[model samples]
Target: MAKVTLTNMCMIYDKENNKVLVQDRIKSWKGISFPGGHVEDGESLIDSTIREVKEETGLTVSNLESCGVIYWFNNETGEKYFVFQYRTEEFSGELLHKTDEGSNFWVDLEELSNLHFAEGMDERLSMFLEKEYSEGFGSWNQHQPGKLQFQ
Candidate 1:
């Protein structure tokens, strides 16, 4: 049997302002990325995403649109990691300036390319920004980095 880990990430879009909320991470996987974290046992994927957003950004989000999923298979350990991706425009509550994870702020979607992104985030961003792709899959070993393909 393979070991599997489940996680989630959400894009909080302020459509009227043409900006998306991003976190400048201070922990592992540092750099700019959306708010997210590991799923708790017995928690639904959507719930986990919502909870993570609230914890990391201090905002409650709803009407989440399922953007897609990204997963990778580890050749050496036979471990698989999955990240559920979501985008939502409906949210409430005051945004937090910073958390133990990082600082939260809005950035123009067009400016994403100019900002430094967390590992593989640029590829992951495609799942949220482009409607054409729904899934991203990749394979890697302990010694090599994985390459993802969107589908």
Candidate 2:
């Protein structure tokens, strides 16, 4: 079977800052990452994101939109897979410093570059936070050995 991985549609909505939330990944985490994780077997991507947020930040999302995905190499494990992106224009919940994954926080959009991040994260997250962003989702066929195509 072809090795396929499911990317969780993760996001952070902070009405307090009027900016998307981001966290400085700690412990075993690769780097600062948005709040999310992989989709469990038989679980839907949308459900995965919402569940992850609850388990990570105690937030509740009423709606989330799939924005995009990124195919890239991971330096640590040398693992490469597509990462699904999602954003919520509406949500409700309180933030707390709790998660088995990493310490969570709200990173200002303008100051996103201040923190270190995993490869390809900045490019993808920036798009998710964009107002005019549309398209950039679905399967990415290998056009070349090291190339990725998104639809």
**Candidate maximizing lDDT:** 1
Tens digit of lDDT per residue, candidate 2, span 21-125? Answer: 765666544677787777889998788888877777787876787776665554444455656678875777788675666777776767777778854465455
Those runs of model 1 whose alpha carbons end farther than 4 Å from true positions after fitting are none
Error of 2 at 11 (Å): 2.6
Pairs of residues clashing in candidate 1:
none
Q: Tell me, by TM-score, which candidate is best.
A: 1
Per-residue lDDT of candidate 1, residues 1-151 (tens digit): 9999999999999999999999999998899999999999999999999999999999999999998989999989999999999999999999999999999999998997788999899877777988679999999996899999989
Which ranges in model 2 have alpha carbons more than 4 Å from their true place?
A: 27-29, 72-80, 131-151
lDDT of 1 at 99: 94
